[model samples]
Target: MATSFNEQFDQHGAWRREFSLRLKLLAEWLKDHDLLDAAVAERLRRLEIQVRSDKLMVAFVAEFSRGKSEMINAIFFAGYGRRIMPATAGRTTMCPTEMGYDPEVPACLRLLPIETRLQPQALMEWRMVPEKWTRVDLDVNNPQQLAQAFERVSETRKVTQEEAHALGFWHPETPEDNPVSDAQGMVEVPRWRHALINIAHPLLKQGLVILDTPGLNAIGAEPELTVSLIPQAQAVVFILGADTGVTKSDLSIWREHLLPESDQEDIRLVVLNKIDTLWDALSTPEQIQSQIDRQKASTADILEISPSRVIAISAQKGLVAKVTKDAALLEQSCLRQLEDALGHGMLDQRQKILGSAMARGVSHLRCETERVIQMRKRDLTEQAIELKGLHGKNVSVIRHMRSRIAQEQSEFDQGGSKIHAVRSVHLKLLREVFALLGSKALKAEMAELTQALGQKGLKLGIKRSYSDTFDKLRSHWTRVQGLIGEIQSMLTAMFRQLNAEYGFALQVPDQPDMGACLAEMEEVQRSHLQYLSLGNTFKLAQPEFAERLVRALSTRLRGIHESALGDVELWSKSAAAQLDVQLRERRQSFVRRMDAIDRIQQAAGGLDERVQAIDQQIAHLDQLEEKLASLAERLVSAGDTVAAAQEPLSA
Candidate 1:
């Protein structure tokens, strides 16, 4: 049997996974060879994360009752053998609902209360507290429980005019924009501001995020969704009611929201939903096609795009067909064409996106590695020429050069003790710094912070808990700073000693900006109190939130620790380089004088042997240069393949 569209999507996902792994391996290779600069390697590492973790965000935007949720259920969650999302007969999924898999959090429906939006704190910070969100446990096997849990998104609450104003839902000039007021003048509004469905669905696990948004009001109120989510989405599917063609509200959404945010024409898809209404049993197939083609042309004209971009489908029929395994209904649904578009359009586009991203990261590194290799080859070529020129001379000259070499060797041998002393000092300073920033101590401190943040049943609430936790973390930062200063002092003393004893004037470079290392953590601290409030006990207790907070803080701490270690390593290498330079200068001076003596003594026997030895060294350098060049070529070619590679779905 031919591969189904769903299986093809899985194959595409597997391709991405395989590509990401290859990039990871290449990053390690670059690091191992020291081919790229440290920053380049870091960029590669970050790219690996984006490749591996970034979900293909497909947002479904429409007015209520357009079957947007049903489309999502049919296309992605059909494997469940039933409708997983709440797609009832009437208006369902009233809020801006997001279906995803947060591996850190368990399967549950986390709903943020609409009232929480009125809080002084930013939405993201407010979202951090679990207690602020209503948690509904979801059992996948028990479809009833799952269905009930998801139904909460449609829940509503009634509030007085004053209460609505307090919740930022009422504006005097735009009074009509507020939820319809009853005879008593109380406004009925959605109970939840946002619904996050965390489920163990296959498509979600494969990194698919479906954003089902209601009307403009919800999208307008939620700045995060408009400013961040919509703009970042990989594809935005705008749903239009086939019966209504294009309503005023739909036009407003198309003009105001979707069009402005989605810059890529290919990523934006127009779905004329409820197409089953267009299906007439008495009409010929050509007649139906003619109507659809006209609708497609009209939609394309309205949206100012090619007619091919508009897709007509019956999401309800699609869902029913998939659930019942009825091929006829499925074909009537025209969902296969939509799936084909998604596979070829969005999924194919994702490969290009990943490729372009990877190319941007790897190109410079490849060029630089190639340059370094070529430069080394040039230097070796010069050395080879000089060695070949030294093939013949007098015996007396050779003996005199040997005597001078002996004298220089004695002087070189004497400087070894000073080299040892400098090295010892550098090693001692590095060891002490690593000991102070030991992983065990850092891990223990992080564990304590996690425990404090995890403290349940706090009378003072989440704000106080985070405040206390951050303060403790700040103390650890202070201790780390003090130890870093101590290490700097030791390095300075060591460098000063070397300069005084040897007249080398070696200076320890100033320490890198430690403040910059902890700057991200400090920025988070400045507004830590703004993150949590009195009513976030449950939000604070969520395993996902806890793990995320811990991971973020731990990453910063690790960065600082790594920064300190890097600084030490850099300083040590600098000190050793200076010593090597002085030693090389002394030896070179001795060799130059010895060459003059050899000329005077007329001793140049065995010069051919010297030439042969030099040739062997040149051959070794040539092989190394060739290997480096080959690796650079491979990196560039791999980047090209990644950038251009696409998995074309069967039409």
Candidate 2:
């Protein structure tokens, strides 16, 4: 049987568990070793806990009066008696609100105030704080309170002008005060600003985080929401009115912000809202369908959708359809496409989570192994230095022996003629003695050393398993590269549109340059021959050993080979102390080079991370650009009439 979405989710859960375990271990090690800063350690601990917890986060985003809150209540809290979230026409959510499933207590409406734009915690302090100033915690179990919350003209606090100005709810006129504004004449104070309500329903606490956004003027007008929230969102659902299949505003939003460009393709879903309006319009069903299809085709051409996956739905009707079993037809007609989109999105997310986790694990293991190997190399280098020193000392000893023999030969030459017979005997003996200490003898010893060195080199050759690991890593990287490329292309197109709309220049880096690093590696490989020259030279030497002696030495070296054959052992011991010192220095150089490579890898990885973060920030900036553009245009238009009014008498 094919794998189900649930099965994929389960696999992701298992990997998450593994990731949590590994992270826990890493945290503990860092703590014990005092390696990480306290704050970082705390963050890791929190992340570990979060990974293990099965909490799902679903955020709702739409223009004001799109019934986002109503949809939330209907889908998750139908059995609950009260409407947990307050949904009304015209900018209902003055601030972003979240709801979830909490069964331990009765339904409650908690209003959180926005004192300043800060972290998510800023709203938490005001949650359930008071009854006035748009702050209230009501018992939602009672239908009366739920109904009261939804009413457009409830007993809500009216903010004074001073309060609005203080809270940054008032529009700024000057260019210096607000970069998003036009020259100093167009400022309008909205009446319904600074009103925020947060409701906690039993269903909300379960696994949903709803963001009830205001209209284009509210959501797009602010840099905070555009630059922070939406880009970070896992999925974005754009709600459009079905009656206005693709309105100027809807198209504007898609073209300016949501559509995938050269640099990004973050998941986006579009819902043609108010589909019930299409049921009995003057247009026939076939005509309406054709219109929708045409619109879809046009949008696909602009936004790059392949199969045209727009869903036509009535948020108001879908809420009603959820309750009755007979409402399947209605529900299917309205929400089946959206359901499919959500399901596919969820499944893709699951795969991404698992894949990222696995990649992280492999990266961690590779780093650890590299560190260990470097340390071992260092130890080997130290030993090589010692062995080189011993070899030098042995050379010095041989030289001294040659000097002594020379002196003896000089003495023998001086006592000539009368001791001709003695001279001849001495000459023969001298020749035999010289032969014992000849270059041939030295070469024989050198040959043995070369063979030992070769054996050591073989040992140092990277294991086949490591090669396999690298191959897998490369394959994984290839996939990541492709995905990143697609995302990058999407972002590029989006950025271009934003630049054109807002008149702000944005230059995106084309495919990042990995060539420099690759070239460096190539250079290193090219120099390998020079690096191996010393060993090669030693191997070329001819050894002058008798058969018996050669056999004896080979057997002896083989016996102690495990201990003294490799570069580690060769450098560790000292037959000639000078040779050992030189070897030690060379080993140190090798270790340093390896360390450099490790640092380079780490730097590259960090660069990749930073690029990803920048991409996210850029997406946020694009959203902000759209909002600012709209506000600026409005300000300019508003200022035009005022300028005319202030003009002197016509010349």
Query: Largest lDDT belongs to which candidate?
Result: 1
Estimate, for each residue in 203-238, the C-alpha lDDT of model 2 and write its tens digit. 233233445555554443333344334543555677
Backbone Cα, N, C clashes tallied per candidate: 16, 49
lDDT of 1 by residue, 170-205 (tens): 656555566778999998777898888888776787
Displacement of the residue 156 alpha carbon in candidate 1, Å: 1.7
TM-score of 2: 0.43
Measured by TM-score, the strongest candidate is: 1
Give candidate 2's whole-model lDDT. 0.43
Candidate 1 residue runs with Cα over 4 Å from true position:
1-8, 31-37, 127-131, 137-144, 175-177, 301-306, 378-651
